[model samples]
Target: MVLEVVGVSPEEESVYRLLVTSGRATAEDLAQRAGLPAADAARILDSLALKGLASHTDGTPRLFRAAPPDVALLPRLKRSADTLELARLEATRLIQAYQDTMRRHDAGQLLEVITGAEALRQHLRQIQTCAQDEMLWFCKAQYVAMPSGSNAEEFEALARGVRYRVLYEKAFFDDEGAVDNVVAGVRAGEVARAVPHLPLRLAIADRSVAVFPLVAGGPHGSPEEPTTALVRDSNLLAALIALFERYWEDAVPLRVDGSDALSGTDGSGPAEALSPTDRKLLSLLVAGVADKAIASQMGLSRRTVQRRIQAMMERAGAETRMQLAWHAAGHAWL
Candidate 1:
């Protein structure tokens, strides 16, 4: 009833209740009963007195008491509270209106080009800072190599409790230093992984923003010179996430052996083993690349690539490329 009339909080109400129940009490006495410190109780009492709901007698050690039940200030205090609440709500609405207008003006749609390594770093920093839930990335190990005086900012972000997931090629296992850096993040419970072979670098933040390089040549491009597309549209982010899921499904968990090595034991190996070339071919097929492209990249003719893929699929006892990718990934074959 007091809060409805005078806009006091529960803590203040407790202090008032203590004074009323005690008839008259010192600040120290009220503090002990209300489970607050003497200083806090004194402040509450001062606020109540200023609102004319309570007062302290000017005697030795000072004693606080609630105002008389029939005090004429009750209605006046209610009126003052109502007026203050109205002003607060009006100011809140005005601030919200300004924020909505700014959002309308700044909302972006099309993909923006981000060129050069320094620019990429800045863009990544923005995503890291803005992330509230999760960050998913597919990157080459080389892209994350720290330069002189450059901190492992990405690792630091993960350490601060950002959920991170990364997909990278199997070659990352060979770079122990790079692998260790990523493993530190994993130990922090900030990361999950998919491995063996990831394509172009892709990053999505909080399911609201995405970044990926427009690989003109191939995956081995210079980190300091790659071109990127930075997208902020929800639809585009969804598409990118879907793509990541597909790749993640076909990638290996980074943990190998009992240790954190790339080739560590996740569980059982494939029912059937495959050569490195077979693994490579399977990855290419699952990615939806044409036979010609696979042939060109692998230095083989279309017919030879097709024959090899056919043999591997049959050996794995799989029918479709999708099934092949699924079983192979499950068994850690590719």
Candidate 2:
């Protein structure tokens, strides 16, 4: 029974065990001990010998001896385990390929409508957890199924080296803790950008599948439940990916980490090196976020925000905010 997994049937094992107990046995002897027919015993013994579980001496009416179980069965079990592992890997590859092919041919498999907030949240989590290479996200204002700063999955994915490119609409920063969340993600290696507005909220994983809202406007508590679509490999998914890239090209990068923010600073650094705090402030400023909003997001008073801007202006030798923006760009400080 223990050797069955290594291709030893119960009958073969019984014949082999009998041979081992006898030290040496002919087919007739093993058949009598195993209570099997002589012909069946001979066949089983041959099967065990072929599997290296038994061997025969060179003589008439050959005496079959069970190979040392530790030496023979261990290797067979190891080989069986190795073969099973390879088969499992191949099966996974084939299943993925088959699903992709099906999605391409069947319209019904291309798009799945997910209704209700709970369902949408589950799909988002699943996609991020399954993402292998990269994840692209369009974050907009107003909470839907998942609110800003609550997607713990992104942090987990990032930790495992899944590159995340997230574009946030300007209004997204207005949400409480949004900027803090973005800073956390950037520090963890997420590439974040900002735009004045986004067409929709979307998330794509590995460029193979996408999820987007089916209804406009986020959760407003007006009894209008949110709906979303899970899109597989298709033309629509391609178009969505293209749209994200188009917007990404024009978006402004957010620099939260001091080292990374200054990594690209061009020739002749600022009069004084920009601290991490200053770099963060500068990033939001370049993104066209107002001082008041920046103050709120950065947990600073508006006066302090203006004071810091003035200080940066003096350091850049810029007379006005516009010139400071230009200086930041020329220096690659953003």
Candidate 3:
């Protein structure tokens, strides 16, 4: 019965397994062993031979050989697997299309509640994979459902030409490996930015649907299970979009070159001469990251970070850190 999925009937599978165990068999031998009539066994054997699962020799009563299961069944299994995957993808598209229609016609269908961490993660992945045009994200620290690097969906979506605009709070970089993840994302065509902070975690796909927490501080911060809301096209969705755009407008762009060095220039005044390290430091500073946090994120000591800031200030003829930041902005150094 296990082989039925690949088009083998239970009776045929039984005959095939018996044949495999016996190595080779005549129609009468298989019939006696399987408790089936000789005529029925002969018919099944012919069917199996036609399916490449068995072969017959040109002799007296004829002999049937069971093809090696590995050779005969593996290819069929692979083809079946491929077909199932295609069906799954088609089902996902059909479900999305149906949901889109319902959301458009029925106002009550606009909001769906996703409860628990695993469910939240699955919805996030589904939306990202289904997204056609763009994805907007507000990534905050102390992640509620999934870790930052666990988002393989983002890369897959990016590969298919889905534009990603992600805004990370400054504290997000304080997490271990967070900087490396951001760098990897940037290299893979993600457009990343850093903000001093964000109010909540959010994701919007194609500007038609949004997902965010129904109440903040769930399993991560409390004993309660996490709860999230999937909102499709409404004034609430528009407000969420506006919230992301507001922070995005002021957030510092995160850029890294092929060499893994942060790189940027405004092409105006002294900003054009700024080094990669300087550009990175200025971006973090402008986002209100603390000196120690900056040092940690950039893999530098606190003293070393201060020294670099001092050098940058002197280069820009700045008497203080504020003046250096002011100059960096004026010349579009970040």
Candidate 4:
């Protein structure tokens, strides 16, 4: 191991050992005593002299001698130690430099792209799970909310005392089981609203971070290859939160009271028929919100909300949505 560390082969070490034991001798005699050929002895001694392991006299038929073991070996070992120290110091500097570069790269990367459907789900679940206070979300596309039964993440957040506010677009209710899923959510304690024309699909957890689709083509309901984004604190995130609030102000709450009055517009335009939830839905419609937007506010399926509107129109004996609204207002349906 010592020879290896010192970069000396076994044959070279043997020759070096022989010279060290014998103190001084001519090359040919040393080779004969050391079991080496004359030519081999000359070459080795010459090589050892160059390596500072041996020295020779200036006389003819030069007399070769081993260097003082203490002097020769100590300086070589010291050089090895110095080289090792320099390498260690260089490794430490490299590690520190790598850490700094990674920190800068991470700091500058506030937004990250996530591809594929299942990957998007994992990211959503992690974000929701980490939310400490609240989660704000908008679901305008089915591709984001499909296979609808995987809603345990939201309930888990609610269980953790995180307030959840979700906005579902009117079209979101068109899915077969969307109304039931939302009703289940309402029972689980999330405060949900429905709106007709939500801008895009998004989920923000703790107001510190957001996840959204970086979808190509259009922002709503495209079933193409899914690509999502993780957005950290930034002005862009602030605007996203602001956009939700703006729509929230006009959203309708989901009321599953099974009230007869809410389902029908009284011909007499009576004051007692509508529940607060019912009134909110109609009010948004009267204020020009589309069915999809109303569904978003209420978390009911778009189809469900449309059915309610159709029933209301039938009760008012109106042929169109606009007429039904005018009649309800004339009669004070709320």
Which candidate number has the best lDDT? 3
lDDT of each: 0.69, 0.83, 0.85, 0.75
For model 3, what is the error of residue 316's alpha carbon versus the real structure, in angstroms, after optimal superposition?
14
Collision pairs in model 1:
256-263, 256-264, 256-265, 257-264, 257-265
- Number of the top candidate by TM-score? 2
lDDT of 1 at 278: 63
The positional error of residue 314 in candidate 1, measured at the CA in angstroms, is: 8.1
Report residue 62 deviation for candidate 4 (angstroms): 87
Model 1 is weakest, by summed lDDT over 10 consecutive residues, at 264-273
After superposition, candidate 4 runs with Cα above 4 Å error: 1-108, 217-223, 258-334
TM-scores for all candidates: the values are 0.50, 0.62, 0.50, 0.48
After superposition on all C-alphas, the RMSD of every candidate to the true structure, in Å, is 12.4, 11.2, 13.5, 18.2
Tens-digit lDDT string for candidate 3 (1-334): 7999899999999999999999888999999999999999999999999999999999979899999999999999999999999999999999989987887888779889888888989999999999999999998877788887999999999999999999888777777788888888899999887765789999999999899999765646568877889998878999999999866755567778768865321111255455577689889987889999999999989997887788677667899888988988887787
Q: Model 1, which residues run further than 4 Å from truth?
A: 1-110, 144-151, 174-176, 215-224, 256-260, 264-334
Ranking by TM-score: 2, 3, 1, 4
* lDDT tens digits by residue: candidate 4, 140-259: 746553356576888898998999998777777776677777777777887877765677788898888898867743322555667778887777789889988866754656555554
What are the per-residue Cα lDDT tens digits for candidate 2 across 47-164? 8888888899889899888889899878888999999999999999999899888877887799999988889899999999999999999988887888777899999999999999
Residue 179 of model 1, lDDT score: 60
What's the true lDDT of residue 249 in model 3?
Answer: 54
**Model 3: colliding residue pairs:** none
